[model samples]
Target: MKWQRFFLLGSVGLVSICILLSTVRNLVSINTNCPLSRVDKTTLQPTWPKNRVTSSNLSLNRDNKVHVIIFTRWKYGSTFTGEILNNNPDFTYFFEPIRREVYKNRKIHRGVFYQDLIPMLHNTLKCEFIDKNYTWWDEENKSLDCRYSKKLQNSILCEKSTIEKRDISAYLSKESRSRMVEEICRSVQHVAIKTVRVPDLKHLKSIVTDDSLNVKVIQLVRDPRGVYLSRKVTSDVCDMELSECDELKNNLNYWKDPPFWLKGRYMLLRYEDLADDPIEMVHIIYDFLGLPVPETVKSWLRINILKMSSSSKSAYSWRTKITYKTMVTVQRYCMDLLLMAGYKPVNSEKDLTNLKIPSIRKFSYPLMPNITFGVAKPNTV
Candidate 1:
């Protein structure tokens, strides 16, 4: 009986050894030559993909279950926007690319492997972006054949705002522009940029041309009154003709097809209506992106102003409530691009009057060339 017991103990010891070896193999660091490789297999990679400027882009295809890109504007309810989607372990929330410090190191999640991205995966999340100078689209494609060519085309994109006329040549560049394109296509399963302007359409098209990819563009249109009011309160703008709404319209219309990017791919969200019913707005947004409703999103239902002292669910409301000092600088930084994108300036009471928008504004739509602002904001009335 003693000998038999000894044999059984030996067998159990061997099995345990095998299990440990298998786990070590599975958890081995493969993608990055991170320092953790020598220390431990479980240590997180402190430096993200772009930290070292590694050009390795993750493959994005039908294999990816859910990837959402929020191409919106400031004060578009992105906090609640994040709350609506941030709960999902399958979805990732990238609030603002410019001020990425919602986490650590005060750096944006510049680049990452899609496979590594799972749901409920944000480290630190909030919205306090101070540099509107960060509005970088596709600056690498300098050839006029696409967008950055022709002085007239450049004029439309880099136009000075009537409020604060300034030259755009300083901020516009090729490197940052190129990076933006690669980040979108190569990301694991989500790319969201608040304050998407007109020239950015060119960048959108060049990067997202694949027919198989399910990319959705989300545009948040506040009452031109509110937008202008926000712009005025903050004194944010480039050198643009305040009354020249038609020039902005023409520029917006120009980019509608193969040459134009992200036209049919985007969905418009009104700021006021979103403030009224946050959950319903996000619910529809999830449907448009074809993502299952995340349970965490339920926490952000009725937030009017963004608050740093608030809960994580209010992430989408960052624009409504950010540092007062950052409010104007950020707005001024994005002013030129916003103006170029036909961001309507608030005029008469009729302009900022619509908040309860039309039904179609809630769902997804085809990327049409001449998109009419058809939604009726009844609640604002």
Candidate 2:
């Protein structure tokens, strides 16, 4: 009986030891498998999910195909800028995909916060243009004004058969339309979206940083005075209030020290420079994306640039029209941004013509959090 008791105790001790060893092994495995271990040893935690799609993943999946967003403020020559991409056969442009939704919902204003729009734009980049996500201004009339507008219907990716059949049966069910749109989206080599509703760069953080989509942002900035004057001169004559100008200035300031995630992903282009040399500027942008300058785009530039130049004597056409008091207000409001963008203040219309469009300096990105700045120069197309 004593021998049997001793044997039982030994067996229990051995079982406990095995269990202890197994636990140690699991702890070590967990430490080894941690994703953070591969990154720099810092306490900084990731705000986004670990499995989020990244540029690396995009390269592997799409053979380096790109997704471009022409992010611009309202009336900042965004239409013309978007045209550059629209003319490219390789690109399928979506113009203001968020406009109708915002128009339909009063709560969804132009300056609506970033967090609210991130999820919507994320799905949009993935070619998920569901009916539920979008609200049209004329839903009662069954107007296709939002996504299925005449211009977008004629885009390179749209099926001619679908566009031509316009009758009772032609109006496909929501599911059928969604499937058709998704098919076109997936078939395209590249997708370009242009928007005037984005209030700031931060609103695009998720889409631009997302690995699933190869996203690039071309931030088109026009002179504040030009934007203000144009707004004032419009038929509605809505003067851009000081608050609006201040908000714009704040947005520009935010980009000067962009978040670390945005490094090498953001590019700035002045409206004046683009207006002055549209062909060269367009080439530069295409080169930055490592894409060939499409012949169609070059042809479009040649025709449009001539028209733009002939209409105005100088790029700063607002200088002559703006009152002295208003000019002073604009100068004061946009002083910091103007200096950062290398624009000088103009006291008279003569100064506007004499002002040479400055060559934009190459934006530099830092290698690490506090390491040396590296030159990720824009390619001259």
Model 1 misplaced regions, further than 4 Å = 1-61, 79-83, 98-199, 232-264, 302-381
For model 1 the local lDDT of residue 4 reads 94
Best by TM-score: 2
lDDT, candidate 2, 1-381, per-residue tens: 999999999999999999999999999877655542221115322121122233432333346687888878887888778878878777766777776655656564455544665666666668786664453222243444334233346533233345564333134555665555566666668887777776667777778778777777777777777877766643322234455555666655545665766555556777776766555466566644656667777666545654656433444766667776677777776676666655666666455444463323333321111113432333332
My TM-score estimates for the predictions, one after another, are 0.39, 0.67
Model 1 agreement with the true structure over 110-158: per-residue lDDT tens digits: 2332112211111111111222222323233222111311222233334
Weakest 10 consecutive residues of candidate 2 by summed lDDT: 363-372
CA lDDT for candidate 1: 0.38
Candidate 2's TM-score reads 0.67
| Candidate 2 Cα RMSD after full superposition onto the native fold (Å) | 16.5
Clashes of each: 31, 3
